[model samples]
Target: MDPTAVGRSGAVILRPMRVDDVAEAERLSALAFAVLEGNSDLTRPPERAAAWQVRTAHLVSRDGAGCWVADADGTMVGFATSLRREGLWILATYAVHPSWQARGIGRALLDAAAHHGRGALRRMVGATTDPKALRRYRSAGLDLHPTMVLEGTVGATAMELPLHVRDGRPSDHEWMDSLDRGLRGAGRGEDHTLLSALHPLRVIDRPHRRGYAYLAPDSTVELLAASDRRTATDLLTDALSGAVGADVRQAHVTAANQWAIDVGMAAGLSLRAQGYLCLAGMKPPSPYLHHRALL
Candidate 1:
């Protein structure tokens, strides 16, 4: 589809994200958050910028059709990226340059995502700490769920179960997809592929059930999917132990999942920050850890 005007005036246009827009999107993302947090940095640090680029590239490459950018006149002012997995639609990232705030750009981009995700029993999810953004999400019909960011040094905890942990392989795609579908209520095939390629995908196999986690480059656990509290805690402990040398490890824990929070605390992780998971449509009843931007 061609880039089309989404604003009331013809000056503002909305279009699919291209490879060239990655850097600006990253900068805008950082700037938007900095402004919301009352920080001085206009752009994120080098490591954060690089990580954001990687995530943006992953989303754009896998689901570019649902990614939209807002341009005011000839300048890019905002963008929104969404990914579809099974019946779930995730608003991976949405940002508007601080200078362009208060305009209808954000709403326009959100409307574009809503339009693209029309069919199916899709549940849309996103995370944000910004009150204005949360208000916008609510205006767009999403209900908010509280969440917390947990971070700390990895503890010396060990699991004595008869489970085996191994690096995920290409041949394990079907098994991983099925496990994800059963736990998350959606099959994130492309997301798993992209994340597995960029990060260390660890699979935990047990007699009763299986679990998985993605170890991000920053030594944080991106996603931890498991059937029950025991499996989830085991996977989390494994991920945390892998970050032994790192100063700290982080994970996004949902307030609804008290067991996960307890596990994180038991593993020596402390509360770092808090946010909300804005969701629309049917909610999934599973224990899973996710990145704030991509949840």
Candidate 2:
């Protein structure tokens, strides 16, 4: 059992996470990820922490019961946050303080959080390449679909970006949700609100093809979903073209989205296999790039 888990063993107690725990949990998550993802090119810790704080607060507000924290005395040592949108349940983030690893705390935290997905029609998460994490998700019965990432300084491209996309507003919610359902099997619901808080929304709404993408401050494609590959490809072109000369990246892109690969290559971004989007009861969605935490 996790000490401080179940409210038990050692000096730690496990309990449902609250909004107040966001700050400390954010610190622990950053520490854990720094060790897990040693990528020298990752966003600076301060920027990453700020983003983590926003997303963590959003998850806690939307799904308090799905979030759990392991308290070692009064300090948060391990935690997990999750979200459910209808039949889709996803692990938002999970972490244990570096000093506290290998003590079964991570497993306990995960088991407590995974309970939130018990009745979902499908479960998925965009996971890092950590082998232990990989094994854990595999043990939970999700098939692993390795994902690729496009990252580097924005370079010149001859790719024709013939399609155009416009900024999206609240009025487009219904249309976006409907497209999400058709492609991803479930509507994004409140996740859009969270994304809106951190980035700008651009949508392609044509009769033959349609799609939406959230452009991050760093020029990364935060999340994108489209009715077809061409529309998605077009959206990427427009998004990247608009961000030339800035560093950019896109992650959680599976082989199903070859258009993304082709576009990234054409834009002069280097591609590499990075992580896995673990899934159960669904195939990889094409022409879509999942949110880092909200897949």
Candidate 3:
């Protein structure tokens, strides 16, 4: 159990998803994402409530998704979702009922999830156009990596953590909300452009497809050649040799990923210079890569 998750009045409860909690989760997301503190563009369509429903359905499905709800005085006020991929666990979505914003509910929920996810040295990400979310993440010991927007090409900072899969799934949902939060919060992506980019690739041949199973349009190619500049250049040259007319002109690679960076350079993929942040409980075995190879 999460010790930090006491209610505002010191009686709040942190618990797993319940049969009847779906509606409340939707309601909280509507209130929170709709009138988010800083981002106003999200209020323009479908109502935040409608968007919440769609996101909730994605998070609770049996495809390695996890969720948690917070109740204050028996009222559902906040919810969080975590999505799992091969070696990565990302916080996909989270919404706090408007009535319960500044309280410790969010932190408590995060703590509980993190506690449960012990020994994984997790890399979690969060996105928020809302100033409040940015503040909350910072307060909760998350540092800013790179601030990116998914506009013409997918551009965003990548974070990493080493996690051991249990029963072929990640241990928790605490980090799941970050990816969706970043995308929706960034809000620069359009369905048409994404579909157009992803439509032509019938076969995506890339090495590392872990952590990014949710990529929709383009296939992210992940393989490390060598740490040296020459190796980086050669690896990319080889990868793109077979990529003629495969429907991708752009890609993302973690700055720390030496081979991918070399590939990006040789292929004319300009690094949209931004503040990229990195965290590790211990040194990584090799340079970790975060690529925007797919949606």
Candidate 4:
């Protein structure tokens, strides 16, 4: 399928994203999110712009076939990246230049991503705090549900677990995939593989049960997937303990998953903000904690 099949409309063009578009995509993403914050209670860190750029580049490098860009004449106006793994397709990051909003560029870019993954996409998911953005996603066929962001300083804690913690290895992909599927109802093999290589994954090895959490280099708890609340708490406790030297540690939890939220609060984290997890074609699983952008 030619992602660029939808050609120029007046001066706008919808096309597949390229490796070179990452820098501009990062700029537009930062600008778009900053503007979005102005319309909602959401807050973004000053360093997120650079962080988003790096994440965007990684997503493009990992799944370029699922990324698309809307170009106005020759300048990029908008972009969207979707990560397809098994039955899931996540709209990982999406943004349009503030100057170019309301002109259908965003819609086109979104459509291109959906089209590119139509054959394999069983469910689609995304997150946003802005009502206008919610409307756009709803209009595109997703159902919105409440989610929250929890953040606070990470400190040493004395929570002991029955299982031992160890760094994840490539051989553990099968266990990771099985655990993720059991918890989230979908497998994120590709995402887990990429993240494991890019960041450190702290794993709990028990006799029959296993769990894992991704501790980013910056000490943020990027994601945690476990079979039960106790295992989840143990993983999070380990993550927060390791994050003792970092300025901040954060996690995005589904509102329905009060256990996970309580775990964060018990670990000395506070409610930072709230948002919605919009899903299309499936119900979201509970007890899941991941970055909002990756929802």
Write down the lDDT of every candidate, Cα atoms only.
0.72, 0.82, 0.43, 0.71
Tens digits of per-residue lDDT for model 4, 1-295? 4556665556888777887888788777767887877745233464665666666777788778779888877898888898776666778888888788887777677777776557553555556676666777888788887776667665456444335778888777788788766655467766666577557888887876577888866555687777777777777767666666455656467766677676667656777657777777666665567655555
Once superposed on the true structure, which residue ranges of model 2 sit more than 4 Å away at CA? 1-9, 39-47
lDDT (tens digit, per residue) of candidate 3 on 154-246? 222221211321111222122222322332221112321322233221111223321222222333333221323343343334334444344
Higher-ranked by TM-score: 2 or 3: 2
Clashes of each: 0, 6, 15, 0
Q: Poorest 10 consecutive residues of model 1 by lDDT?
A: 1-10
Q: Against the true structure, candidate 3 has what lDDT? A: 0.43
TM-score of each: 0.88, 0.93, 0.49, 0.85
Comparing candidate 3 with candidate 4, which one achieves the higher lDDT?
A: 4
Best by TM-score: 2
129-182: candidate 1 lDDT, tens digit per residue = 777788788897888777777776656664233257677787777776787777
Model 1, runs deviating above 4 Å: 1-5, 157-163, 244-246
| lDDT comparing candidate 4 with the true structure | 0.71
Ranking by lDDT: 2, 1, 4, 3
lDDT score of residue 227 within candidate 4: 75
RMSD of each: 2.7, 2.6, 11.3, 3.5
Error of 4 at 121 (Å): 6.2
Query: Which ranking of candidates, highest TM-score first?
Result: 2, 1, 4, 3
